[model samples]
Target: MAPVNEAARPALKAGTRDAHERRIDRAVALIERAIAQGEEPPELGRLAEAAAFSPFHFHRVYRAMTGETTGQTVARLRLLQGLRLLASERRSVTDAALAVGYQTPQAFTRALRQSLGTAPSELRAEPERLWREIDRLAQPPQPEQGEDAPPLRVEVVSIDPFQVVALRVEGGYEAKHAGYERLFGWAGAHGLLDRLQGLYGVAVDDRRDVAEPQCRFDCMLALGEGVDPTGLPGLRLTRLGGGRYARIRHVGAFDGLEAATDALLARWLPASGERLGDALLYHDYLDDPDQVPQALLRTDVYLPLQC
Candidate 1:
């Protein structure tokens, strides 16, 4: 199945509803502005006024159109910027916490742990540890597979909760691949594995599903809390956008990922429109393939479709 073209959606009259589009545009712009300043966002009521939406209807419509509560989206944006600072800065954890707008270090730590699953200190100690792991995997061995392998037994479902570290990129196909490899190497060299839940390839652009002319992708790593970005070089962290997705748990290899993706978008999507909502086509690995291949592999491929 051909990938859905997000640009094409703009041409569809039903997708261009005046009220919904304004809400989404306002919400997105608000976030972009907040991230740039590295701070907490303003009240939803004020945002609603700016978007020309009544406060009572703004929250519901915003969530309906964007597939996220306004608070969740804003909180995530602030935290991603905060995590980057924490990982790359040399300042004390308390300083990093305050830099991102937390009233206190303890409050920041509590939020960090809930979101990323690690305390602040362990994340700070990953530099040396990551480097060692990268050195170990410098030369990866080939995998051997049986010719008659059964269709990799897998279950396709919907996933709405997951987080990832994503860097937006614009470039050639080869450059994208190389970028991800470098990111993987960086993650390993920094002992990021200990702090990360897993590694992921997150698509942040509307053009990704399109062909060569427009496709773009975000190379990402999924880390728990405490993975500071204070001292890391040339990296930015962005959370995976949360939403409804058609999910699949595939085993064996990542090579045939497209085929599974097709099944959801082409085969299942049309039938499941009633339960679907506005969301992106999302994909996330259940575990790291580097650590174990043919080792009970699990991956969730999320394709946002109308419910």
Candidate 2:
């Protein structure tokens, strides 16, 4: 990846930057709670209060940070959850439509097709096939000598095959931790939490490649032999593709991701000869920054290589 020439971008003052981040985090929490409840969303004023910002500014900043209005964010979340239900429960298209608060089936299908790029029927069929494969691999013995580790570059290396009990997430990256929370909650409910030994935040879309902020990511719980991926509620088992990358590990909250990513693109990539690959530069969380000390976040980032 070549260094991104950001000579024209403005720099933020330190104090103002911190204040902005704190405000953004508060706003994100309010919206996430509303989605998890899955009922009538809170009023705009109430949400503004929760974020400690005036309603007018709240609406503007919330959209600025998350790339969608509060209302749009909640609506998209319901639709993603509805799609999951459709794939896993094999619910009638009509029922799935209504479950997500859609008034009519036609409306739901139309939106689903636009977002997913496939008809409901075709989408449903793919899950069925994935489920079957996951079920079949239900206790394969680990290779005695596991191989496939490649030179630690910032490039995507072909990863060895593995199964995961995953929850599909569709939204901007800013709201994704909520999806991870729900996924972890589901794992706990099913006694699968212990099985997430090698957790992965599987990003299907690279933000660097697309201008739109509306993209989906799959927050996957790495599965061992005991976890069955078949017929699980909104669960999926997938094989991740690998290639080249530019990797880094940053300590602290995901809030600094944009800055860290920018640094990698502007400072590091140019220093090295590697070019960003077609795949998104990947970030692997090695330690829970919340639990670990400030200096010990084992987050490894990978940027794809070109030459």
Candidate 3:
């Protein structure tokens, strides 16, 4: 994969997304940098302040983007630091542990074992395996599906500019049904209902990072030519500046969306000559979950690509 180009056009188009998306991306990048430098991940309160989110909400947002709780991500990063110290710097076992904030060498070894299924001593003899172990353990298990699941199809396509009437709700990952319920209710009460052109959703945060109540999700519907959402309760006008997107289809139930997204970034994007950046992640819902069975619902995941 080519290196990330900070000045890419996709990064420029990212300005079209809600500002909060950019803030969250910045906060995550900060935490990632801290960990890479062998420093402690910032405290929740401090991170929240930096991200311009409340402590309670930022935790959930962090999980949504990284697919791991803050503590889990930090632990993994620290262990990685320990591996670098031991292998690359040739630090002693005890010193290496201390370098990454572990109180004792034994504690570090235990964590390494738990996370990688390999003890420190074993890895010391074969240091190259540390990264391999990290990759193996990070992969989420793919959901089981029979031949009924649609074959994965991918395309690089340009999206046209469009506007959405959306509402942000905080809840657990699978519980987003209630948010959409509220959105539809408000839309109906305002007599703004129309023949659906396209159903849409923006994942504002991840559930795995916090309590279900704290996870933030955005659900929206495309604005029809004559539809006006002005003064509508709980609905805000969001404009997505369309650009080239690497659109991939998820053909199974919603439960597998996280894993599918993970696979797209970790397994495919790198080799596809693309780099992930500040561009807003958007979800295009093609089928209504209410009308269609869970197994048949289709959602397209879009990641902005540099033109």
Candidate 4:
């Protein structure tokens, strides 16, 4: 999905409605602003105070809402800032460390190596190699199909047609989080969060056939009845036609979807005598990543099948 335009966001009303989302937004904004300003990491108590939450309950609330603890957020932002200073500003390791709130170059190098699998000096010396490593790390582990491993099970089922509000994005699938975040914020503002029925990811291009930078993805939220998106500017409504689909349950990180899909197409289809249908393949996300552990994230990959 494309990065959301800040101006396109709906104006939120002041009330008790969506109070949790508002607080989360405020906390996230505070953390981001502090990071961008090169200030020391905000204390947990300070962040909680800014979000109008008690420090005692703030950590659990932040983790439930954002999928990471407050300390993790701080560390991640600082690490990203350090990387930017090293890559874009061409700063030395020592300078980048201090600039990003690390006490010493050694500490910065240790964190960098832990996060990116490369030392700061190595990143400066061989940027391309670092990218290759990062890409390797991004790939999901391929499932082992040995005799001891269970076979990949696929169930063919008929699904009814559905209406969705989709945000089209052109780029790597890893970037879809921004689109989903925007959708969540919009839904919260409109008091439509409870009305959401499902979340779907439509893959417009096969990553194996298209370059990562040119791939297309759509982040879709399935709208329940009576939740009309009509007259809503910047909202694109799409109807997914009803059809027979081969569904494969994928259990793990989002990165594993591609590999699971590959397994379905390469191993299952030819053996099952199933022919492909005209409609695009998509994923039905069953668990919210923000609230679930990565190892337990569940998604159902649906491939349109010939009737």
Candidate 5:
């Protein structure tokens, strides 16, 4: 699924942004709940009401925040539900298709091809492989604001909620150095750079589905409550709720981050008997590319986990 190309929205005030995000979470939860019911799910108007937005506004707001249209999320959820049913062998293909709101097995198979890159029967026959190819499509590592673990070594740890002064950017990962420089300049000018304890990155959208030009990320520096930039231009302060997280280090370039994330999600997660946590994955920058070689640059990928 291609990322929707939407115009930039005005910057959000901290309180308003928090409320908006929470509402989005609520709206998504409702959608997921309906998907789990294995029924047609709720109507868009009802979903909007639950999210406290008009149907028209809700559609736009949802895409703005999550980098996906409401229809895409709903479709992905239904497809995943169908895939799970097939994997568990709990339902025949046709039954699974109907449960996910497909009117016919043919329609279901066609959707599976479009989204998962494989037919329903193919996915059922090779669940793990199919899962590897399509997992990011469902929920790529996301940002809930947290950072560094050891390379390839998986560790489980708890994170206390923290705050950061962040600027959202769009474009290539390395091209984001300009964005980082702007952030550093702001912090330096305010005398906050030296006091900063950690530098972090939030993968706001998955590149697999988002065009490079449209990818959104947050360049953040750890800022305590005492250092508020309430009215700072191009900067916002947000809190990422903390919990248990599965942390792993990705050595080498950011380009390979996807495979590293996949290792954790597709390989390590199921074997650990742990479930994916609600928060998005965060990157803790360990070395500066300007100072160190790209091959040696390191980042810690943190995957929030259900404890």
Candidate 6:
């Protein structure tokens, strides 16, 4: 066989990189979709098969590409989903525990505290503080800088009442795409796709305040006029009572939304003299993640304010 041409080596290497990234992305998406659909965590062999890698080498490959073991990924995803359920107040700790694949509530609590440094009860009571603590612990120490950061720009705007058909997802916010996939499928099947006026996320639990398992995010499709959700079996129809809101536009990855929200609730709200309203915080997804790059994704976070 002829030796590989030196000039073509970079192209070959780039092709290999692309193939590896595609495989990793496929594996990650499979894991996330299964979790979102409330399915048991896929076995390692199953994941390996899905990624078209040998079972023996898949674990190492996954870890090398993602910087975490497969078990670690499953555990993190499960724990985050469990926390979302817990925060929703709709499920008992025991229920949330089982729903997220824990054998019992005690086991879930132990893992929660060990991994997140907060108990389920503590998360319910002091969600914001505990969430902040988790975020702090997850990051490396930062250097103190002079106060020259740009101010968080917020606008007080009145929104009209609207209704949405939402699918409740009991997982970390990152798993929400699965819920959207289901919602879109349902709409497409019923020929209601054209009636989807906007895409919204109802944060049942403030992600910045709650543990991942205790957070509840609803993947919502804003309904156009005259659409009733009476026959939707698995979905909920929620009417958002339109009112004044403090809105902050977050630009960049979804991961940064938590910090933006913290800035809003901690700094902006107090300074703006706005009291929290009797409604949940929600998000308007301005750009579709599938179409936009992570750094360019836009989300408008809205905190309801009293009239």
Judged by lDDT, which candidate is best?
A: 5
lDDT of 1 by residue, 149-207 (tens): 33333233334445566654565446566766777677778887566565567544333
What's the TM-score of each model vs. the native?
Answer: 0.39, 0.39, 0.59, 0.49, 0.53, 0.51
Off by over 4 Å in 1: 1-162, 169-177, 188-191, 204-214, 230-234, 241-243, 251-255, 273-275, 286-298, 305-307
- Candidate 1, 282: how far from true, in Å? 2.1
- Please report, in order, the local distance difference test score of every candidate based on alpha carbons: 0.55, 0.56, 0.66, 0.69, 0.70, 0.70
The CA lDDT at 213 in model 5 is 94
Ranking by TM-score: 3, 5, 6, 4, 2, 1
Reference-based TM-score, model 3:
0.59
- Total clashing pairs for each candidate: 30, 24, 2, 2, 1, 11
Winner on TM-score between 1 and 4 is 4
What RMSD does each model have against the real structure? 22.0, 22.5, 9.7, 19.5, 13.9, 22.1
Whole-model lDDT, model 2: 0.56
In candidate 6, stretches whose alpha carbon ends up further than 4 angstroms from where it belongs are 1-148, 206-214, 230-232
Write one digit per residue (lDDT tens) for candidate 2, span 26-105: 66566556545545667878887776656534553454444455666666666665666676665898877777667788
lDDT of 5 by residue, 268-293 (tens): 55345555555757888889888989
lDDT of residue 127 for candidate 4: 76
Cα lDDT for residue 292, candidate 1: 71
Better of 4 and 5 by lDDT: 5
Total backbone collisions, model 4: 2
| Deviating ranges (above 4 Å) for candidate 3 | 1-38, 42-73, 77-99, 102-152, 173-175, 225-233, 276-278
- The TM-score leader among the candidates is 3
Which segments of model 5 are wrong by more than 4 Å?
1-152
Residues 1-307 of candidate 4: C-alpha lDDT, one tens digit per residue: 2111112113244443356547766886787787777677677788888877666445534554454556667777777767767775457889888886888999999998787777888787887765554454333233333224457777777777787888877777456887787777778888889888889988775554467888778898986655555444456878664777778889999877766775665455544555556676788899989899999999988877666
- Residue 67, model 6, lDDT: 47
